[model samples]
Target: MHAIALTDGLPILDARSLVDVDLPQPQPGPHDVLVEVRAASVNPVDVKQRAASPTLRSPRVLGFDGAGVVRAVGDGVTLFAPGDEVWWAGQLDRQGSDADLQLVDERIIGAKPLSLGFAQAAALPLTTITAWESLFDKLALTDVSHGALLVMGATGGVGSILLQLVRELLPGVRTVATASSDDKREWVRSLGAAATANHHGDLVGDVLSAEPEGVDWIFSAHSAGRAADFARVLKPFGAVVSIDSARELDLDALKPKSLSWHWEYMFTRPVQRTPDMVKQHELLDAVAGLVDSGRVTSTVQTVLHGWDAATFREAHWLVETGRTVGKVVVER
Candidate 1:
């Protein structure tokens, strides 16, 4: 099988940061499925891992989001068969989907949406999982009847899907989004945002101008530093959920309003091998159902060809630039 891997963590500019290599085709474990990867997508995790993680004794595969057909399944894998098409964000600690073939736990896999192609399907899993878990699981904001919901960095991968899901799942809930560009503002509006603000300017004022009373929920899909700004716009006793990590946060700012802060890391379940790992599969299934029902749409913005290191690096660069409006995919 052909694979793109990193023998050492280095700057992506270095040609050796990622290399193309040939390895034996991976076989599935008792509860695993060997997928013939048809397409893959890059996330900030890939860029961070490549730049910061130390060199590994073994060359590390570096992609997480993928969609493909099942080539084989382990003896205990009954959920899917050899010919089934599936999409999943593989476990963070394991070899990823940046190869011709990849192995993933059956419990974390889901049937791909019937309406989308491999590249389109590949763009959803990682971002959708993050957004779904952040909003519904960790923050527990399934019922939005109380007030409006604010989505920061609303034009990014997670934000795009998150916006649509909020609209579908929380009907009649007022939704606000922040997008710096005119195009992005229009995009979020199409996704059902009640209002759109500029993240580049005063986010607090921007959101407040739209909803003078303040919002009920804040989902920061961008930086945690934006949490302070989000806190200002949040109604009393409202909650804030963030997927990004920040070095410094003024927790005191949220105290006066009695605001609660929660951080979500979608990979935590798979990284820790948690007891509820199967929930990821269930969540993906729900997302697929939404897509099938036309309630949700793929966030894939740019699709590149080939699964080579060069292509992967280009995708990484686009994401790292912080300007990509949606997910960038790579097809085989």
Candidate 2:
């Protein structure tokens, strides 16, 4: 099997950061499926891992989002067969999808949407899981009746699908998405945002302008320096769900408003092998239906055409730029 791997935790500009190598084909575990990876997408996790500490004893493949075909399945795998097409986010502890073949647990994998190509399907799994978990599992958006939802950093992969999900599923709740520019605001608006705010400007003012009162829920994609803004813009007893890391958050700021903050990490279920791990598969299947029905769409912004080191380096470079509208995929 051919694979592109990171030799050490180095910058993407380094020539040895990502390199092509040949490895033995991986075999399936008792509950795993061996997938022939057709396409893969790069995410922030990949970039972070590639540049993180602890240089590896050997190269580690670093892709998380993949759409592929099952070439073989273990005896315990009931959800898919050898010929089934599948999509999934590979577990962090395992070798990733940046290879010709990968072994993934069937519990977290779903049937790829029939309406989409491999590249399109590959662009969704990781972001879709994050967005779905952030809204339904963390914030409990479905239970809220009539309130405003703020989607901070609304031009990224998760925000792209999240806006559509809220619009299609929660009809009563309006959304205010944040973008830094005119074109980005328009892009998020096209994805179903009721209103758009510029993240570079006064975020609280922008959101409050759209909703006279404070918002009921906040989905923080990039939450590093916005803790004070979150405290100010959320209504009393409102909740916030974040997916990023923050070094300095003033917890005292939330006391006055009785604001609750929650962190969402999509890899928890698979990493812990939780009893409800299969929920990821179920939600992904449901999202696939949404895609097939045209309620949701793929967030692939740039599809780089190749399966080599240079291609992946370019993908990482684009993602590291932090200006991409949605996802960047690598297809064969």
Clashes of each: 0, 0
Which parts of model 2 have CA positions greater than 4 angstroms off?
Answer: none
lDDT of 1 by residue, 94-195 (tens): 899899999999988999999999999999999999999987886686564647888887898899999998889878578889888888988999999989
In terms of lDDT, the best-performing candidate is 2
User: Can you give the lDDT of residue 302 in candidate 1?
Assistant: 98
How do the predictions measure up, each by TM-score? Answer: 0.96, 0.98
Top-scoring candidate (TM-score): 2
For residue 12, give model 1's deviation from the true position in Å. 2.1
TM-score for candidate 2? 0.98
What residue pairs clash in candidate 1, if any at all? none
